[model samples]
Target: MKYLGIILSAIGLMIIINSCSKSWTDYSALQVQNLNQDSNTALNNKTYQTYLANLRSYKSSKHSIVMGWIEWGDKTSTANSTLNDLPDSLDFISILNPSNTLSDEKKQDLSSVQKNKGTKVLYNLNLQNWDDSLYSTFNKIGYLLNVDSAFQSQLDSVILAINSLGYDGVDVNVEGMNCSSCGSFFYTYQTGYYNRILDTLGKLYGPHSNTEKFLLVEGATTASLLSGTESYFNYYIANTNDYSWYYQVDNAYATIAQIPGFTNDKLIITTDFNDKSVSADISDKLWQYGGIPFYTNGSGTPIPSSTALLNWNPTSGLKGGMGIFYINYDYFNNDFTITKNIIKTLNPSGE
Candidate 1:
C-alpha cells in the first residue's frame, strides 16, 4: 500500500508540471505574436511619417511636383494647354527651346493660362540673348553670367524685362558647361560664381509668394555639383542618367543624401526613358535617392519607354514623384494615351 501511494503521488506531480509547462508555452507564443504586430505597425508608421514630412515641407503641396517642358511648335499660342492637360497631373511647366522673342504681352498671356490651375510657368532662356545683336552661341552666358561685371548691365535689362512679364520665375540652361572658355576661373577664382546669375535673378524677380523665389539651373556640370554651387539654386538638374552601372542606385543615394547631403526635395535626377534597356527600374532607383525624378523622351519617340509616368509604391520611404522631359513631345504621337497611362501607373493613380 505504501509503495502504491508513493507511485500515485509521483504521477500527480508529473501531471501538474506538464500542465504548467504547456501554459507557459502558450503565453510565450502570444507574447511573440504581439511583438510582431507592434513591429509591423511601427514600420508602417515610419513610412507614413516620411510621406507626411515631405508633404508638409512643401506646405500641403502634393508630395510630388509633376513638371514638363512646353516647346514653341507644340502649342497653339503661348499658353496653349492641349499637350499640358493630357494627364491633368502637372505642377510645373516651363516654355523651352527659347526663341528669344518674348514680348511683354506674350509673357502676360502665358502667365494667365497656367495660373488658372496654379501651375508655375517660368521664363526659360538659353545662352541665346533675346537682344539678338548681342547674341553669340554661348557668348551671352560667358559674358553676362561670369564672375565679373562684364555683363551686369545687360543682365539687369534682361531681368527688368522678364520681371515685367510677370513670370513665376526663370529656368536658365548652361549648355557646354564644361566648355573650354567656362574657364578655370569658375573653379579657381570664386565659389559658385555661376550662381551669381541665379541669385541676381531671384532677388530681382522674386520672393514669389507661391514658388518662394523660384530659379532652376539645368545641365549642371560635375564641377558645379561638387563645388556646391548647386545648393544655391532652387533645383539642380543633374545629367547622371546612366542606370547601367551596377551600383548606380546606391552611389546616387550616397552621393546626394549621404555625402553632400541633399534630399530628393532638392535634387532633380534625369533618366533616359527612351532607352529600352532602362524602363520601369529607373523611377525606383531614383526614388530611393529621395529627390524629384524626371525622365526624357526626345522628339522622335512620343512613346515613353516605360509607358508609365512613375513606378513608386512607398512602403517604407518617400517617393517625391517624377515628371517628364518635354510635354510637347507627346504631340508627335498625336495623342497622350501613352503619357496618360504612365502618369496613372504606380502613381497616386497607381496600377
Candidate 2:
C-alpha cells in the first residue's frame, strides 16, 4: 500500500512538471519575439535619426537649394494641398499667406515638415496687390513703412511675429516701386526706409548672421535700393518678366552681379509657370548664370520649362538652385511629379 501511494505521488509530480515546462517554453518564446521587435524598432529609429542629421548637414553645405512658394490651405481640403504633402527633399518654402489665421491643423502640418524634413519655412511678406484677408498684417506694415514715420514699430512687430510663430525666415517681395506720380524725395525716402528694414532684418537673419534664418528679397533691384543692403539678403530673386531670351537673362545676371555686395550665387532667375508661352530653353539657361530657375507665370509651357530647368546644369559648377511660384499647382494625379523631379535633379542622391 505504501509503495502504491508513493508511485501515484511521483506520477502526479511528473504531470505537474511537464505542464510547467510547457508554459515556461511558451513564455520564453514570447519574450524572444518581443525582444526582436524591440531591437528592430530601435534600429529603425537610429536609421531615421541618421537620415535627418545627414539632411541638415546637406542643407548647411555649399550645395544649391530648391525653393517653392505654396499657398497655405487645410490639409484635409484635397490631396497635395498641405505642407506635409510637399516633396521631402525641398530645401525651402515660402508660405504665400502665412498669418495668425492659420488653423491648428495647418500649423501642425508646418511644424511636422520642418521637424521631420529639413525644409526651411519662410514667411511671405508681399507688399503689392495682396489679399487683405490673407496678408492684412504685412500689407499694413508695408503701408506704414511707406508713409508712417513710426514704421519702426511695425517692423518690430514683423520680427516678433516671425519669432513667435516659429518661422525659419522671411521673403520680402516689394513690387511697383516705380511710382510715376511720386516725386524724387518720396522715392528716396521710401528707398531708405526699405533699406533700414532690410538692414535690421539682416542683423538678425542674413546669411552671414549667427542665426540659421534666411533673409530673401525681390523687386528691390535698383542700385540705390540694393547697394548697401545687398549683403543683408541671402538671395536677390531677379525679376523674370523680361527674361524671354538667353541674352536677357545673361544681361540681367551681369547687371545684378555688378552690385557692390551682390554675388552670382545670390541671384535667382524666375520664370512664370502660368505663362505657357515662355520657352523652356530660357529656363534651362538659368543654370549658366549660377542661379536657380524660378517659375513665375502660367500661360502654357510649364512641363517643358520645368523639365528643362531641373535637368540642365552648368558645366562650370552646380547652379544656385531652382524655385516654383505656385508649387501646389504642380501636384497633379495625386503626386508632386515636377517638384520631385526638380529635387531629384538638383540632388541626385535621394534624400
Candidate 3:
C-alpha cells in the first residue's frame, strides 16, 4: 500500500511538469501566407459593417491615418466638397498629375499650378516621352522609368521650382525601362544631378535652415526590379501587381522578401476602389502579411468615403488603408451613404 501511494504521487508530479513545459514552448510566431494565390472567401456585407461599428465602439486610442491622391486637372467641385467636409482625423493628401482626368476647360483652373507655388505637393510624372514642354513651371513631377537629357533638364527645372515655390522634397516613381538605361534616371535622382538640383534649390529655398529631401521609388513587386539589391531606392514601393496592395495572398511572403530593404513608412501597396468585393478571409490574410491598403481615387475627383473603404466589423474592419483611385471621383463618392457607413463603422473617429 505504501509503495503504491509513493508511485501515484510521482506520476501526478510528472504530469504537471509536462503540462508546464508544453505551454512555454508554444511561443512560435504567426504563420503568414501569399495574397495573390489565396482563394478569396466572400465577405458578408453586414458583418463588415458590424466590424466597422465595433472598431468605432471600441474607440481604440490609435487614430486612423487617411491619405488621398488629388490629380491636377480633376473636377474640383466634388473633391472640394469632400475636402471641405473631410473629418479632422484625416492626415495628408498627395497631389499627383493634375491632368490625370481633368477636362480642357476645368484643367485651366491653375489652382493646382498655384498649389505648386505654395505648399509641399507630391508629383507623379510618367515619362513615356522626353518632351519637357508638356509640363508646367509650378508642378512637382516624379519621372517614370525612361531617361534622357530632356527628362534631366525637366527634373532640374522641377528642383528650381521647388525652391521658387518654397516646398518640401521629392519622390521618384520610375518603371518600364531597361536595366542598362536606368543609370541616368538613377543619377539624376539618387543624389547626382538630382541632388545638385535639390542642393541648389535648398540654398535658395532655405537660407535659414537645412532642407531635407526624401528619395521615393515605386515598383510592382521585388521582381519588378531584377537588377538585384544594387538597384533599390528609398521610400516608395509601387506594387502594381498586388491585388489588395497590402494583404497580398499571392506570393505575399515572397514579394515582401524581394524588396532589399522594406520599412513600413517606405512601402505603399496598391489596392483598388472596388476591393470591397474581395473576401474577408483574403483581407485578413493581407493584414497578417503586413500589406498596407492603397486606392487611386479615380480621375481628378475627391475620393468618395464609401468606395475608398468598405464594410467594417470588430475582428476585421478597415477595408482599405490609403486611397489612390484612378484620377476619378466617381468611384469614391458614388455611394456616399455606403461609404460613410463603411468609414464610420471602421473608423468612428471620422464620425
Candidate 4:
C-alpha cells in the first residue's frame, strides 16, 4: 500500500510539470509573433519615411509644381474639405478665407501637411475682401498705400497676421488695378503704390528673400502691370477664367514671360473648374511654353475639352507643373480624381 501511494504522488508531480511546460511553450510562441509584428511595423515606418523624403526632394527639384486654391473649412468632418485630406503631392496650397481664428484642430492639420508633406501653405490676400465696394476704384489694395491715414497699416496687419498664423507666404489678388474713370495718371500712381505694397511683402517672402517663403500675385488684368515688381513674386498665376480661346492664354503667358524678371518657370496658367465647358487644350500649349498648366476638370474620361488635360504632356522634356482651382470640389466626386491624375501624369511613380 505505501508503494502504491508513492506511485500516485509521482504521477501527480509529472502532470504538474507537463502543464507548466505547455504553458511556457505557448508563451514562447506568442513572444515570437509579437517580435515579427514589431519588425514589420519598423520596416513599414522606414519605407514611409523614405517616401516622404523622396516627395520633398521632388518638390525642391526643378520639376513643374502643382498648386491649388482650397477653401479653409475648419471642420474635418467632411471628406475633402480639410487640409489634412489633401493629396500629399501638392507643392503649394493657397488657403482661401484663412483667418487668425483657426481652431486647434485646423492648425494641427495645416502644420501636419507642411512638416510631413513638404507642402507650402499660403494665405489668400484678396483685396476685394477688404471692401468690395472699393474694388472698382484705386481704393482697394491701393488704399493700403496711398489713401489710408495710417501708412501701410493695413499691409502691416496682413504681414503680422500671416507671420503669427504660421503661413508660408501670401497670394496677393492684384485684380481691380484697372480703372477707366480714374484716368492714366491716377492709374499709374495706383500701380506704383500697389507695387510698393508688393515690394514690402516680397522683401520677406520673395524668391530672393532669405526665408523659404513665396510671394505670388494673381488677378492682374495685364502682366505688363507687373513689369517692375515681377522679381518680387515667385509665380504670376494668370487668372484666365474669362478667356475662352487658347490664344488668350497664350497672350497672357507671352505677356508675363515678356516681363523682365518673369520666365516660363514663374508662370502658372489656370482654368476655372467652375466652368466645365472651358477647353483644357491650352494645357498642351502651356507645355510648349514650359509653363505649368492648372485645370479644374475631374471627370476621369478625356472629352475634347474635359479632363483630357491629364492624358497629355510634353514628350521631350518635363513641362512646368499643373494646378487646380477649387480643388476641394474635385474631392466630392472621387477623392481628388483630376488632381491626382495630373500629378501622377506629370511625376509618375515609376520615375
Candidate 5:
C-alpha cells in the first residue's frame, strides 16, 4: 500500500508538469502569431490625400508652386524680405526657424505676410537634434513610442500659432532620426513617433490642407526607415545641388518611389538657385523626372530664362511646374530678379 501511494503521487506530479508545459507552448504560439499579423499591417492605414496633388498645377493656380525658406537663427534680419516683398507668383514659404519663439520684428513680418499676401505660410519646425534640455520628447524615443499620448498634443500649439497667424499649414523637418549611439531601436521608436504625429496632423488637417512635411529624414533613408512613411505626407521639398542636380534629383525621387505608396509626381526638387548653370533647358530636365524644379536664391547669378522655355511644351516630358525661393539673400538680394525672370518665363502672359 505504501509503494502504490508513492507511485500515485509521482504520476500526479508528472501530469501537473505536462499541463503547465502545454499551456506555455500554446501561449507562445499565440504571441508569435499576433506579432506576425501586426508586422504585415501598414504603419499608416489612412489613404494618401490627393486633393492638392498635381505639382504641375499646384494650388489650382495654374503655375507651379515656388517654395522659399525664411530660415531663422542667422543673425541677418529678414525685415526687408517681408510678405509684401514676395511676388504674386510665390506659392509656399516655410518659416524654417528652430522654435516658435520669434523676435518682435519676425512676428511683425510673419503677421503682415499672412494677413496681406495670401501666400501659404507653412510653419517649419526643426526636431533634428536631441538636446537634453529641450524637446524632451526626442530624448527617450523608446519610452515615448509606448506612451505617445503624453506629448501628442504638443504639436497642436504650433498649429494653433499657425491658425492665430492665419497661415496655411505646418511643415515639419526632422533630423537625427538615425542615432547611431541609440542603435536600430532608436530608428524603430522614432519611426513610431513620426507615425503617431502624422496620424495626429492628418486628423488636424482633415481632408483639405497639406497636413505635414514630417518625413524629410536627415539621418536614415533606408527602405526600413522611409518606405511607408511617405504616405503620410503629400508634398515634400527635396534639396539638391548645382553640380549634380540632375542625378541627385533622380536618386532622391527613386528612393521616394520605393515607398510603394509614393509616385514620381509627389516630389518637388527645391534646388539652390545660386547655381549659374541653370540654363533655359533645365526645365526640360526637371520635366523629364515628372517633378517641378523650384529654385530658391542662394548665391551666384541664376541663368536667365528665355522665351524658348515659355513656349517649349513637351508631350514626352512630364511637366511639374517650377518656382523660386523668398525675395532675399545677401548674394541674391531681396528684389529676386532671377526668380522673377523664371516666373515670367513660366507665365509669359503675366509679363
Candidate 6:
C-alpha cells in the first residue's frame, strides 16, 4: 500500500480546500442569469419559428441538445462518420475517448478530426483502472500531465498538436480500474489536472480559452461509496460544487428525485435510454427536478432529431436537460443527418 500515503495526503489536502471554500458559491445567481440569457437569445433566432412549428408537432416544453460520440481509433474512412454526418446546424459533438486504447500511431491520426465541424468537442482521455501499475503510471502521467515541468513540456507538445489539428476541448475520462488506498490520489490527481488545464488553456487561447472545456468522468457518484473516498468529494467538490457534475444514472428518475438538490442545477442526470419513447418518459420526470437530463443512445445508433422540439407541457415544465447519446461509425448515414437536422430545426444557437 505504498500508494496509500499518496492517496491519503491527496484527500487530506482536498478536505482542507473544501471546508474553507463551501459558502462562497452563488448557484442561484448564475441560474437566473443563464435562464434570462437563454430565454432572450431564443427570441432572436431565425429558427425560432421553425422551432415553434416543430413544437406544435409535439407537446413538450423540454429543451435539450443531441450529441454523438466519435471514437478515436475508428478507421479513417469511417472515423468521421459522426462528424461528417452531423447536421450543419447541430449544437455540439462530443469526441469520446479519442485514444482510449489506441496505439501511438492511431492516436496521432486523430489530430484534426473535428476541425471543420464547428461543433464543441468533449475530448476524452480515460485512464484504464487505478491499480498499482496504473497509479504508478498515472503518477508519472500526473507529473507528465499536471506536475513535472520537464515531462509536461513533452505532453504539452502533443496536446498543442491536438489543438492545432482540431480538438475543441478535453474530456478527462479516468474510470473503472482499481487504485487501492490511492483513491485519494485519484481525486487529487484529477482536480490538479483540471486546474492545470484551465490555467494553461487560459494562457494559450486567451479570449478563445478552452476554459469553457468540459470534463467527464464516468463514475463521479460511485467514488463516494468507497471507504475513504467521501473526502475526495470534500476537496474537489468545493471547486466543482457550483458547476454541473453529471451523474450517469439510468432509470434512476424516481430514484434520483429523493436526493434533494441532486435534481437542481448542480447535477446533470444522464441515462441510457435505447430510443425516443423511453427517453421522453425519463425526461418527463427529470424536468420537475429542475435538473438537466442526458440520454444515451447505444453505439452506432442515433436518436430521432425531432426530439429537440417535442411539445412538452408537463403542468410542471418541459424537461430542461441536455441530450447525450452514444454513437459510432456503424450508426453513421443520412438517417443520422435527418436526426441532427431535427435537433437543429428545434434548438438553434441563439436559442
Best of the candidates, lDDT = 4
- Estimated TM-score for each candidate: 0.54, 0.68, 0.41, 0.70, 0.56, 0.40
Candidate lDDT scores, in order, read: 0.42, 0.57, 0.34, 0.58, 0.42, 0.34
Cα displacement (angstroms), candidate 5, residue 290, comes to 23
TM-score of predicted structure 2: 0.68
Q: Which stretches of candidate 5 lie above 4 Å from their native place?
A: 1-60, 72-79, 98-108, 130-153, 174-181, 206-232, 241-245, 258-265, 273-327, 330-334
Better of 2 and 6 by TM-score: 2
Model 6 spans > 4 angstroms off:
1-63, 73-82, 99-117, 127-134, 137-158, 174-325, 329-334, 337-351
Residue-by-residue lDDT tens digits, candidate 3, 212-265: 433334443534432433223334444333343223333443454456554333
* Model 3 lDDT on a 0 to 1 scale: 0.34
Model 5 pairs whose backbones collide: none
lDDT of 2 at 154: 58
Pick the winner on TM-score between candidates 1 and 3: 1
- For candidate 4, what is the lDDT? 0.58
Error of 2 at 2 (Å): 83
Q: How many backbone clashes does candidate 5 have?
A: 0
Put down candidate 1 lDDT per residue, 184-217, tens digits, no spaces.
Answer: 5333533344456655665544332234547765
Q: Tens-digit lDDT track for model 5 on 129-173?
A: 332222344456355653354445556676677666555666665
- Candidate 5, residue 242: CA error in Å? 7.0
Off by over 4 Å in 3: 1-65, 74-90, 98-120, 127-148, 166-168, 178-215, 220-234, 240-253, 256-260, 272-321, 327-351
Query: Could you tell me which 10 consecutive residues in candidate 3 have the lowest summed lDDT?
Result: 27-36
By TM-score, the best candidate is 4
By how many angstroms RMSD does model 4 differ from the true structure? 16.4
Cα lDDT, model 1, residue 111:
44
Error of 4 at 335 (Å): 1.2
| lDDT of the structure predicted as candidate 6 | 0.34
lDDT of 6 by residue, 1-351 (tens): 111011111221222222222111111111211222254553343343343333322222233444444543433443334343333333345564454234544333332223222345555444342134434544534544443453255347537644654555554333344556556655555544444443454344323343544333333443422222221110111111111212222222333233323322222323222222324444432222212232333443333222322322123433333333444322333233334433443344312
